[model samples]
Target: MSEAPVPTGLFSGITRLDHVGIACRDLDASIEFYRSTYGFEVAHEEVNEEQGVREAMLRVNGTDDGGATWLQLLEPTRPDSPVAKFLERHGEGVHHLAFGTSDVAASAAEVGGRGVRVLGDGPRPGTAGSSIVFLHPKDCGGVLTELVQSAR
Candidate 1:
């Protein structure tokens, strides 16, 4: 008989908050609002064809430890994209909170074995050369969550 997966807190090996993803109807306008209103600067911006979204990462306050957080704005590039669906359901709001991981594949395995609904079979390439996977919101306190391992 095969051994069952062990249950744990599902937070082991997590490092830090990578970014807070937000869904927006318009990318440029949202970017403008953060810049003009909050004086936030875009650290990175790109269109992820695989994910079907145009995204911008705005830098938040920096800490003395040199750690940084980001406000990730996601704009759908297609009508049927996840971001589009999120907009339809939530009407422009926080989409997912991404946490940094030292080993995404391992983290995904651990989190998935703990009864979390992982969005994919495994982690895939994300923006800024990161490996990422999402945990379904239904199993994550009604908030979508992403786990990211920095490409090393």
Candidate 2:
């Protein structure tokens, strides 16, 4: 068997792992757990009505360089919300992995061009004023993937 060559420029804009989204039944409890257990501190918190999630971004360690990776705790605000549906199906655990990108729209287009399914028509509003889009799990090795362009 022969190995296939890696494609170029498919994820050129991806800079780093931005955050790991964890679906939770209670946002406050999850925050407290991470705080007491791992000493992680909340960096930002917001309720995104469009996504139907009350989310908090926790800094794993200290944010000395202003580029610390975050642990995003997401709690559903409604029964029909995506977080709620994920919790119902998989219980409390990781929901998605977000990668930091310099340009989400361009990155999504580039990846989509390679046959990976982009979940929406375009990038949408994300936490902390960032723009985000999800790549379909079926095309992403069964793990839901998110691309985030941090607010500038």
Top lDDT prediction, candidate number:
2
- Runs in model 2 deviating more than 4 A are 1-11, 61-66
Kindly report which residue pairs in candidate 2 clash with one another: none
> lDDT (0-100) at residue 88 of candidate 1?
89
Residue 109, candidate 1: alpha-carbon lDDT: 85
The TM-scores of all predictions, comma-separated, are: 0.86, 0.89
The TM-score of candidate 1 is 0.86
Which candidate leads in TM-score? 2
Error of 1 at 103 (Å): 0.9
Error of 1 at 117 (Å): 1.9
lDDT by residue (1-152, candidate 1, tens digit) is 68885543356577668789999999999999999998999989999999899999898966332346789999999989989987988799898998776788988888889999889878888988889999998999887899988666
CA lDDT scores, all candidates in order:
0.86, 0.89
